[model samples]
Target chain A: MFNAIVSAGTLGTALDSVSVLVEECKIHLNDDGIAIRAVDPANVGMVDLTLSEAAFESYEADGGVIGVNLSRLQDIAGMASSDDLVHLELDEETRKLHISIDGLEYTLALIDPDSIRQEPDIPDLDLPATIVLEGRDIDRAVTAADMVSDHIALGVNEDDEQFYVDAEGDTDDVHFELDRDDLIDLTAGPAHSLYSLDYLKDMNKAIPSNAEVTLDLGEEFPVKFHFDIAEAEGSVTFMLAPRIQSD
Target chain B: MFNAIVSAGTLGTALDSVSVLVEECKIHLNDDGIAIRAVDPANVGMVDLTLSEAAFESYEADGGVIGVNLSRLQDIAGMASSDDLVHLELDEETRKLHISIDGLEYTLALIDPDSIRQEPDIPDLDLPATIVLEGRDIDRAVTAADMVSDHIALGVNEDDEQFYVDAEGDTDDVHFELDRDDLIDLTAGPAHSLYSLDYLKDMNKAIPSNAEVTLDLGEEFPVKFHFDIAEAEGSVTFMLAPRIQSD
Candidate 1:
């Protein structure tokens, strides 16, 4: 029953959000909200857990899910508690399922996977153009901007078939441009957008620097990120909404 | 001037070994234990640095390259430092060039570049076969093994054209085998070797995960890792001597 995103990021530290579910002999987990699922046989190992939460209480099918005291589970799991890991165990005496992840392990907290509102509802975005580049390039751009400011502008010029990512502030300015010749593909036309250096960074998350990343852009919209999980036949995608500008 | 490889390792927690030389125009650094001669402008930036090491008691030369600390530079560039960044300006005051980054200033330290090993001589290794994989795959393999143990064994079987990566331990056991059908390409024979997981992680230092990586393997010998820094046209390599079996 320990399933749900448990991250509240400040800065510098990494973001870790995981969801895990247990049913009889099966355990499924998708950490980082990227839907990279892993199934491992429990092999008869039993755990004691009790927790409660709104996400778990709403479930009323044949079984019940509960909100776990993620804080308490964090103790047994070590520093993993900072990220809000929940744990839940089914109670035989009652139809209630007990869960504990963080510290409030009084009952299992059920979450409406659909209602939790993790991925924002992305409209049928008509991206005017796109550029596929190495994640490191974006990282470098972001870091370069970070040297001076907190945001960067991204755009593509169809005439030159060139892509530009630039950030400028009082003390420093960085501009990285690439012609169509360098990329797997570069598609664009008179469209540009500015996104939070942080959000763009979040979408990239823990992806390796040299990994291939596709950037889809609109005048003022979200960004989509996709990457592969090494040997496994799986991929993860993250789409982050854009932040409004002050001026 | 301190720029040396502790060993090949995954660039983790910190790149651990990224540095830059700062000077107004040129500062005659030392010819000591390990002094760096500017090879390409690619390895460093054209201006501004929060380098890690402090250059002290520098000797003279026609040109100068001050060895700044990598971590210190990152800290300043990352804005983690409380002290004002120490900026250096030289006046050709004698043979010694003094410099500082991020507030902590010191008289230049001199070293003989000739005295320091430029590149250690790596024997012309007769590898069984060489294969290239997306850099991230190797990074993931190391991460996967890192989660479970300190040692990982890599092997290839020619008959079926398959490669295997296995890690066995009390808490975890993982074996991943990819046949020719699943890989970019597979050349097999009885070529195999076991290396320290730590060194493999070390090779990741200063490199991003998505860069193209080539793995050179022999039945029971050192593994040489080559990384192509995407678009930079620069390459970094690590020659990891094999770990001898205790038995």
Candidate 2:
């Protein structure tokens, strides 16, 4: 059970609209240190992530069966290169992790096994507002919001057939909406909530720009995104804590 | 008129870098519908690149003059998102180039580009032996090659201070040297060549584990990377045509 605020920061950069799913993710022990194995499948979009042996030089693993640090493992996964020396190791006594590649001879420690925690269990939500839109549309709306503001407001009107994402900080407050009919589905009963720009930015990496994405949303509950990674069917869901408004 | 290649065949992936010198580049119209942007400042490293935008949508340039087919543009810049769009116009015939934040958008037309006409040309390099490595490694020998293959060599010499990248095919053979000293320098040479795998992967985006990066070379000719792209830079020295293969 491991959860982390691991962000690939893929949105606005290259990946958008689609969903990423890690079907089988785990932390194991190896001769070197703790090893992490995640089969993440997402569309082969415009971005190709790679890493050199040196970039993953520093690793840490302990225990008879080393513990896995999901975030650090994700970091190393994010830097994978085609020609990289890709290998993972686990510890035996402390249950920590270690990572290394063939290029860099020395194996580096990744992180403390204790730092990684499980994703906060999401309460069963009977959401008041939900909408289904093309992964590409949300990607576009993010672009529009990017034009001026970083803060995005997610809301729904009781009678309206769509959901909206509006960024008011910029002069051109981008209003992105997918009408009920336009969306695969919509259950709008009235809701409102907001989040900062960063969480969305980080969340983008986990989501693809092509899948038909579903928004499991409510006024302030963690916005849930459901989509597929690639040929390997998987999902990367992030629940960002709401940004309490100061004003 | 200057001719360079920047398309799906040659410049095979995303082409941008921050740590290196190549900050900006331009492209324009030619009979073949391509222009060259040389890095006279030796700040350019994207030549013969190749990458593709797997899933892209269509959009018109807002209030811009240059009207180009969206799909055609992908052959040049791969996928783009409006959120990352920068309204760049060249004179009245304007064009909008959406790029990653780390990317510098340089738009130029082939009205009359700076010329590069070598008297004898850079001598038709007779590329001999060549081989295919990971397209991502052309820039990341620092850890994968440098730190590991401190000594560079083509044939198996247990005690040679080097390893070479070779690709032998119907066309030219590509070769790259990675000696301990050479690797030491090449790591730093990223500046001299203004090349960074991190950035190249960002702009032209190629395959990580799938795409095979081909290398070509001779005893004394500059190493040539055979990639696929639909465009090229200009007459400036943004790209380096090997002078001679020597330490």
Candidates' DockQ values?
A: 0.01, 0.03
- TM-score to native of every candidate shown: 0.37, 0.40
Top model by DockQ, which number? 2
Put down candidate 1 lDDT per residue, B1-247, tens digits, no spaces.
Answer: 2222111121111223223222212222333312222211222111111111222222223334543334443443343232233333433444232444445444543333343323233467778866666665565566555655688887787776766676655533445566666456655656677777765665554446566666677777776666543132234455566666665
Tens digits of per-residue lDDT for model 1 on A1-247? Answer: 2233322220001111112212221112222221222111321111111111222222222232223222233222342323444343455454233433232223323333333222223345667777888878777777777777677788787788888877878877888888887776887766566766755554444556777777777766666555543322234445545556556
Candidate 1: residue A134 lDDT (0-100): 85
Candidate 2 C-alpha lDDT tens digits along B117-208: 21122334445534455545544432232322222223211255344443222311223454544332221111111123333333323323
Each prediction's total of clashing residue pairs, residues at least 3 apart in sequence or on different chains, is: 81, 123
- The CAPRI classification for model 1 reads as incorrect
Measured with C-alpha atoms, the lDDT of residue B74 in candidate 2 is: 44
Runs in model 2 with CA error above 4 Å? A1-110, A115-119, A170-172, A245-247, B1-143, B146-247
- A86 Cα displacement, candidate 1 (Å): 19
